[model samples]
Target chain A: MATRAPKTKRGTARRETLLRSAERVIGEKGFAAASIADITRDCGAALGTFYIYFTSKEDVFRELVGMMGSLTRRMMTEAVQDAPNRLEAERLGLRAFLAFVAERPSLYRIVEEARFVDPDAYRAYFTGFASAYATHLEKAVAKGDIRPGDAEVRAWALMGMAKSLGDRFVMAAEKPDLDRVTDEAFAMIRDGLAPGGAA
Target chain B: MATRAPKTKRGTARRETLLRSAERVIGEKGFAAASIADITRDCGAALGTFYIYFTSKEDVFRELVGMMGSLTRRMMTEAVQDAPNRLEAERLGLRAFLAFVAERPSLYRIVEEARFVDPDAYRAYFTGFASAYATHLEKAVAKGDIRPGDAEVRAWALMGMAKSLGDRFVMAAEKPDLDRVTDEAFAMIRDGLAPGGAA
Candidate 1:
């Protein structure tokens, strides 16, 4: 479904409000339990107002998943843009990822829920990220910034590590200590768990 | 809900049949959409027989999640039992996990569904695995079989890596090459992505 951008500033703000409210309601109550009425009510908007910007609850949920994808890519890119090498970039990228998860835990939950709610969207989100991630690793290899290996495999492995760490350290933690989690995890990422590695 | 084990040999066989059927049906249809009738139908059992073993659909689903946890731990333990070192165990454990996913893709989906269907069970599943895994890593560190690091961080990070790689290379692949995926990922796990490590 094509959810075109609103023309007017007020319409745009209202749409954003609906989207944020949907994120909260759907993320908290889940897609099945969450309703359009709940989403609209969360933002203090009339039930009819939800239809003006989106077609259905699925449409809005898909939009939220899409927003998560773009926001994550943007956040990661900006976080690692100025790193001197791929190794340092990995550190920065991971730290930024944990921070992002802490900041928008609901969005993370929403993206994961997409696996069941919208399988195609869920596949697209990870595949898109993995493809781009693999390409970056390829460039890093060509530049001699990292070891030579299967970029696709490396990308998936690293992504998994980051995702799991985010789940355990940020999402599950009552009081998250991102600094220590990142430090230890990033250390492993940089040097691995094998004996005789860097200090 | 206390679902006592059926005492008779025939009763035990029927319960197994129902659980296996539940795994296939619920895994395919998802927890919300799946019904006890569907599960019993898949196993060619009468509707009344389901209640003999299970209190409700939720009870059976929780049991499946619990089963996955124990089965996974047992499988990993057996897979890595003969490894000479912790690093080797990591490799063996990961390969076994992927193979397990391939063999029982439905069960894999069921455990993942637990994250949404039964949140406490989901936490228990991972937390249980991570705790055991961390202990193993601690032993390895003491023995100098692996580098010294935060065992908990290493455990979760490695688990995440294996999980993500399984999702992409095995779960998502049309014809999975478990050998190559295992090798590539295990290499990164052992030596890491740093430029000047093992060749």
Candidate 2:
């Protein structure tokens, strides 16, 4: 006879527990060094249990990427929707991104490691987010709020800048003032790329 | 007493051979995975001779970063100096950067792996290059050739963009149209940041 499945709530709780444990292990030991036994032991689960939820470490990594991406998108969407204008939306987006990275430095390492684990997965994760941001940028450009240009490229460039800045500042062992860096970066973007003279 | 230096140039040549061999091995198998025996064997040199010039595998990695940095700076300097105008200079600099990366994808991996091997070394390597580029950018900004802003931050942003672009195109196993991407990136920078739509 076939075995019964676990209750939905219990399965999700176990999954969340395992994911948290995996993140910590991967963060401390790196993706390559962290083993299934280590993650299961940390999560207080059995080795077989990990296989039930994640086929391998790579699956857990992909899930991490998806989870972070979804969280980031949700936060950014909320912030953008709250903004009254394009410039405000841009500022809000930058702040939200920095804030997210500052809160979860390990996530940065996970994302960085993903590039090596699977380039295709990395491209998919990045392109998905870039497309979402580009949609917002296109609206701003259409409204004459920002300069007319390739919104997709601009979105990627902006995201790249933010990621670089965060990697340098927020993820540093000795963190800097995120608020200051965010303001400085946003000012550069606004004054550097705005349609008119030095917005 | 310290052993007298070899009178013949053979010692220096042997050292160079070992360094190159180490680079190749590390490039293929990663720094952590590449054994000293593998490197020495690749060079057809005695394993003991490897220790004569370098303290350890990590020392070889240190030297690799320095070599790559100097090579990059030289190529970028030449490219920029040869260009007649700011836009041309930007294009030349980018083209140089991409070409250098395309020719040595292994060096790219080594530099990134340095973060895991030695964080301080990684910071020093990046700071050295960033400062060099920033100085060049500052000079251009002083002459009103480029946009008015924090030249250092702008330099970092530009470098970051190039790095992200390179990771996507040049370092991929399946290389993209690097020349076209370089041109497009330079064009975007010029048009997006030029003083008066001159680009």
Docking class of 1: high
lDDT of every model, 2 decimals: 0.92, 0.74
Tell me, by lDDT, which candidate is best: 1
Q: List the candidate 1 regions with Cα displacement exceeding 4 Å.
A: none
TM-score of each: 0.99, 0.81
* lDDT at position B89, candidate 2: 79
Clashing pairs in 1: none
Per-residue alpha-carbon lDDT of model 2 for A34-149, expressed as tens digits?
99899999978999998777877888888877777788888889877878887778788878888888887677677767666655667787889888877977887778776666
Error of 2 at A108 (Å): 0.8
User: Taking the true A–B contacts (Cα pairs closer than 8 Å), what share appears in each candidate?
Assistant: 0.87, 0.11
List model 1 lDDT by residue over A95-156, tens digit each: 99999999998899999889888999999999999999999999999999988899999999
